[model samples]
Target: MSRRPGRVRRAASAALLSLLLVAGCDTGGAEDAGGGQPAASGAAEVPGEIVLASGRDVTGRGGIRQQLITEWNRQQEAKGVAYRARLVELPGSADQQRSQLLGALQSGSAEYDVVNLDVTWVPEFAAAGLVQPLPDRLVDEDVIKSVAETARWGGKLYAAPFNSDVGLLFYRRDYLTSAGVTRPDLGKDAGWPVVQQLIGVLDAARNRLPAAYAKGWTSQLDASYEGLTVNGVEAFASAADGFSLTDKEGRYAGSVAELQAGLDELRNRTQAAYTLPDAVHSDEADTLTDFAAGRTAFLRHWPYAYRTLHQSLSAEQLGVAPLPGKAVLGGQNLAVARGSQRTAAALQLVAFLTGKESERCLLDAGFAATRVSAYEDGALTCTTAKPAGQAAASPTGERTDRMPRDGNGRPAYARGTLLPALENAVQRPRTPLYGAFSQTFAGQLARLQGGTPPSDAQLAADLDRQLKRALPSH
Candidate 1:
């Protein structure tokens, strides 16, 4: 393991970080507070205004969360409940939100009651005691099994899934049809191999697709950022526990060779013109926006893009499928602030936010649900297609997953696509030093994506060295 500096490349990413790496990582928007004093939790019940802080304000009209909070507030007001809940909006950048929350929590401030955290930050917050672990009653199996799993670390439930996300391949059905190409089933097959085949097919058919579709495929491949790290994990490292990049006991389970191989494959694919030329500079929004503008036949992004693109594309034109690789999981989770005086009330709000009805409402608002029932009752998924060379299928059967629809009642994107994608989301490395690892990994990946990427062995060796720096020794 060998190469580079210790300066951490921090940025204010957050729900923009699903806004991608907020698939949706870009530069972060806020500052970091790493040296805040540890705060103690208030076990007693002090009721009053409980503040729920999140990176994004998914409240208000069309915000399923807002509706639930409104109802809760009404009940509280009517009953004169000691504590009533309200929302405290934060910066849109996921990373910035993290910085602010860290600053407050480390400073021993009780400014917040319920903390809506990014799934990736659970470990850091939990270790710092910035948030308290949840009772088993809060995070149950009823939440989407995989999503709920993100809330736990060392077998403790530190957060509750509020809304969850996974990456998917968004392709144009019309373009594929024009090319006489049958869309590939990305889910049924594993991530990287499926992507390889998809790229090959798209490359071969690029000439046949419409001129409006300027690119064969597009993704958040910009180097020097978290987006590339996500792509790398999605490709070669999603096998066991996603981007954890290590085994349950916290040892490197993925090899530099494996990651390098995938990077080389991507380099070849992009060089072959299957990926957009601008991809090296693109992030999630750039990729989605280009695809939505009909510039590309396919895109890889978080499901968060569906609502943003709904106005531009029809359901029929947009085809959703599993990503060739599993998606890096994105979304927010609920935790009670450690220093809050309204512990009991905050816990209640956390339950309500992560509860069944709330899940359904969130799903309908275009946020991916963290509960299986939300997808089932809300109709968010369809059975995926059989693997490549197998029979194509539809979201048929007597299933009851709720369909994601727009205000106009049109399907937001499609089923099977997002649902399967969410199920296959890979978690990132769960260390508190995620920013350091991400920064290092991103730099090496950027170097590889360059015209003269280092030899595989050299690149792999460099990666190993950097990760050893960012990660604790086994």
Candidate 2:
């Protein structure tokens, strides 16, 4: 993810490459671009205009914005629709985008009719009445289950799934093969058992490899941030005794007794003898640089890494799979703001963007489409879908954003592994005060990883308190 140098230094280690696919921190700033009614500024919502605000996607040269905005505007005019929709690009930081949106909405002056929200922001937006649940017909009638789940809140759909993302395990294929270990299938192997199996393999060959290969696994740990929360949720979601993050009512869970095993599993993995040194202090970028330099055997990152690394590494040398257990799901969703004169036009815009045709554009632009059919479009050169050496790029270079293609323009990733990971990805805790929760938990998890973990009872109590604090009574 692109950020100012100071902001980059402040990022939680888990979210380095995850700027492409993961949780966001707290909102710290506000910005505005006209077209909304304000409580004090006296700004008036423009007639026949729908403004959509969202964070900038930076996976490629232009950030992952598809041609939907221009195309939609043209289509509307062609169809004799009077309303014209435009995208007001927000800051690259999700936190800052939310802050801007919140400030605008609260002031009653924001003219944004369509708000592009992170998947995790649905509950908070819905709770605050900033955005309205979509009509049944506009919702994805045939979307993938994993992504479809992101649009619903309190049994009602508030948003439409657009693009999606998940964590991936990037490995040195050349190193693994030479070391006589075949990389395990992530979706097939599934969960913590396979993590251990792979861990064992790495441990066994730790001394056998060149001394430069110092660690077997490298992921975000020993820090408190959304990444820590995501790592915990992934482990506990499938761990023997891990509790579900949502209760019977589908709200953020209150009890933590069942989460202990998941936390323990996290401890087990972080404290593993083969983990990269200084990992607790390294952010995603540092670890990625190290991995590219051949310092580690395995890395946990977002799929976007394939693009950046493919500039030099061959498909044979770089392989990606789903993270063991599960990976955190990340991406954006389109919601209609609660107050807008052109709600109908706004909904139409949201539908068009999230539809199959637009999904193809999203994928081509380096974002994972929520529509399953987008992958089947002959354009994507994904290993799971097309034959090896058979791949295609978007006419405008957007397809490279969806999945990586080699110099010969062949598929550089195994969609078989990557797709399933995105499909099975889980959410971090769904709370309005996610930033607060992430900060508190990241600090605690860092303590745990730093060899000063609190007792399970204490950890549980603190977690419950944090979760409550993240979504207190209104």
Candidate 3:
């Protein structure tokens, strides 16, 4: 989760909880261990205590990971198991956490039993031999098949999915209807031209909607790693098949022409500005906040933004659809640490966290579940609509007064349509050097948006330079 600087303060209680969870697990709350040796070598039985190191702030409200850990601890303790959980919350940025984790692991000072890694880091972590392969007995074939495909390197499973997320198109139902445009049958394989046509229709009728709503579109355009990973690389991958930014074969499949065209459309066609002047430098939270505040008519964001947007706008006014253009797939995964002393316990923890009961808990806490079974649970199907007696009504009464209907006019968001879009969605390049590549890509995209035309030769040269810098020995 991303947050704007000074937009909101971290909740005190949640922050405290985050710290306590981490400190409780640390061997001695020792702040730093400078250049310590790697962990001792031994595959022993489960230890009495287990530590879970995470990159997210668990103290924040709506942190599903924090809630999952807390629930796991409670359930395990009740069953008379002697297991204890300690959480270590790192800074929120993926780069910062990655640097810290690499330092800790290389120095053999990191004491985490199970490490929560971003999906893209699997290849790098596995290549360095910093994480262990999952045991076969603990996870079923289907679960293994789903996660391993996303987190694999050289045909080995390095991580299991912890939480999953993806980009979906959020539109204004009332706006579309008032424009006299019944849902255009863009069909399942809708592309950029179709989306542009719809945006044009909305822009023409902007006067019909509330003044608060924006006349155009909004998405991640910041120059940060997320901007490149989500908007640039993902878009390129979706437009073409077998396109990977990084693979063992070491071939980069992105095209500068396609990337430039897409970025131009984002700027000129939608008239959408970056959250900040250097939006290519911003994070996903910026886009989410803009959409939630009614500043944009259409947005591409993960489902986690659903509750927040629902709280900000009425159902009649809010519309959730698959992204009009190509979108990238995004989600988190779970993995056992190579340095873990409690393999059995760690595997157990993974099983419990990804199980049916835990998925229900996560869904109830306002997070999307990865398990197919959780989607059908009755508890996950319910949503509270805006109170009818509220003084203000949604400009599209279809959205404001009653529970917003899904694309099919059902009582809830369309899960049937949403999940398939995410499952079949494209992903960023799976490279050990994805972080560096994203940085370089974001810079190029920024220049392109500034009216510089991009050429494949220029991008190929830049990528070559980045590859050398990121992987000198390779």
Give lDDT per model, in order: 0.63, 0.62, 0.56
lDDT of 2 by residue, 54-146 (tens): 776544333334245655665556556566776788864566788899889878777888888888788778878888877776555557778
Off by over 4 Å in 2: 1-49, 63-66, 77-82, 182-187, 190-212, 222-224, 248-256, 282-286, 376-415, 433-436, 465-474
What would the TM-score be for candidate 2 when compared with the true structure? 0.77
Taking all chains together, each candidate's TM-score versus the true structure is 0.78, 0.77, 0.75
What C-alpha lDDT does candidate 1 achieve relative to the native structure? 0.63
lDDT of 1 by residue, 330-406 (tens): 88898888888877667667776676655654555557877767555543222111111111122563222233464
Residues 1-474, model 3: lDDT tens digits: 243353332243233323222101101111111111122335556547678787763213325465556656665665566776666787757788888887877677977778878777787788788888875443454342333366677777777666666677776666667666787334666666666677678768777766765545666666645665477655555544555555564345444454444444444433333122323433556555555555565677776555456645676677777775555666666777777777667777776666655544443333455665545544332111111122223345432213343432232553565556656666666777777767776666665555565554565455556545654333
Which stretch of 10 consecutive residues in model 3 shows the poorest summed lDDT? 23-32
**In terms of TM-score, which candidate is stronger, 1 or 2?**
1
Ranking by lDDT: 1, 2, 3
Please give the lDDT score at residue 311 for candidate 3. 49
